[model samples]
Target: MCAPKGAAALYVRDGLRLEPVVHGGGQEHGVRAGTENVALAVALGAAGLAADDLADGAPARIAALRDELHQRLAAAPPGCVRLNRPERKRLPNTLNVSIDDALGHELRAAAHGIAASTGSACHRGNHTPFDLARSLGALRLSLGRWSTADDIETTADAAIKSATER
Candidate 1:
């Protein structure tokens, strides 16, 4: 199921970048061409409302978990780890960190059941040559409404273990 609001609200332009994917009798004010998924739209709307309601307390809890994870990882050997992005100007639930001598893909692959975006592509065999991936070991971790304290602890342990392993 899909909803138009996620991509639609991201734009500042008066119109979309291109035509809709499934062209038919123009629907969704001509922004989306296919028949609307009414159930999905309703679910999206309800989730949005619930998220807005939880926004105040949710961030504080998420921030606490994120900070704890950062602190645990920071306890690793000096010069072995660094934050890829500055903490002062980021979302409370997002952490981007780089572990020296540890490739992001390798660490993530070894981290069972954990999901994150890798900023390093050192393990790529026939990779697209990107500048950042060629030199960084960044992992982008994002905690959501469902993330638990146990999850954060496990992630931090896995990351620290991966970074320290030969």
Candidate 2:
């Protein structure tokens, strides 16, 4: 069920139904009743449309960036790092590399300049691994729309340097 916003259309075509968890008007859908947020719905629809338009081109761009990042990081000394997600099955923008020698807390503290996460933002400052990571025995590094080639290079360099120095 976890997919990018661009893939929602595909899911819809695959017969996945999204029932309203909360309805705006009473007796409209027989779901939870509440006032509808028309503005939010319009914004979401617009964003989805934009994503759909760019999805075809996005995958290739993301893949190239991801490959470059992996190539850079994989060159680091052995036992210093490990990739959490298998390359083939992972989201293209994600590169969840594990600093095997450093704790997540230490990594976070060291990565002061880079806007990266040890795991999930929801668990920020909690000194805990993401719930998913805790359950699955893996860490995470989620990339997003703002991620650039330079950002990747800087982040990877900083991370590797930090891990080595630690």
Best candidate, TM-score: 1
**True-vs-predicted CA distance for residue 12, candidate 2, Å:** 8.8
In order of appearance, the predictions have TM-scores of: 0.70, 0.67
TM for candidate 1 is 0.70
1-166 per-residue lDDT for model 1 (tens digits): 1234542232546654666677777676665666667766566665564466376687788888888888888887666667766778778888878777777878887776788777424555654434354335778788877789899889988877766774
All predictions: root-mean-square deviation over Cα?
5.2, 5.9
lDDT of 1: 0.71
**TM-score of candidate 2 versus the correct structure, residues matched by position:** 0.67
Q: Write the residue-wise lDDT of candidate 2 on 54-84 in tens digits.
A: 6657666776787787778678866556676
- Stretches of candidate 2 off by over 4 Å are 1-27, 49-56, 120-139
